[model samples]
Target: MNVRPAEPMFVSVPPRPQRLLHSEAYIKYIEGLQADSKYISNWDKQLRANTENTPVPDQSRLPTHWLGNGAGNHGSVVNALWMLRDFMMKDALGINKTI
Candidate 1:
């Protein structure tokens, strides 16, 4: 499903403005993102609107859970989301190949 981003949500591969190797820039960026920031609220509103008639989704999983760290706690989730954003940007940044 296509979910519009709440923000630009760009995570540049290798980060355009270089910072410490520790990558505090990545950490700070995702720290501000939330499940609601990824159009999850839109999905939720649609679901609520359908509840009165349509059968809401069953046995379904939404990708937005990762935004809220549904799989684990803070650090791991942060890394996962950060990496995902970086991967999505790879092609546009001419980083299609990985070693």
Candidate 2:
């Protein structure tokens, strides 16, 4: 009887529900935000200040949570979406590397 070596097998892995949010659509959304005039202005200001060695704001003394008119709540939703997008991109890179 001859013994044969086992061949490596590739398995298709499905993304979790949360990770499904990270897709091309999400990347486009982020790009859209970057394209907004207000967002660009704010980002440019921050970058310029950082390059000029401006003192950092004292965020350590700020309140962790503030009760506001639904703005904060909406911010949380946006944050979750971004998180999902990041997760999905990372997962994609990992899959690409394995292949």
Which sections of candidate 2 miss by over 4 Å?
A: 1-75
| Model 1 residue 87 CA deviation in Å | 0.6
Q: List the residue pairs that clash in candidate 2.
A: none
Query: Relative to the true structure, how large is the alpha-carbon lDDT of every model?
Result: 0.51, 0.51
Candidate 1 CA-lDDT value: 0.51
Candidate 1's residue-wise lDDT over 1-99, tens digit each?
999768866866784786656456577655756865864234555334422454424324334575654435535543455456556555554755553
Least accurate stretch of 10 residues (summed lDDT) in model 1? Answer: 50-59
78, model 2: CA deviation in Å?
0.3
Candidate closest to the true structure, highest TM-score: 2
Q: Model 2, range 8-99, lDDT digits (tens) per residue?
A: 69777997676446666578666767543665334454334421365424545333344233234446533443444456657875997889
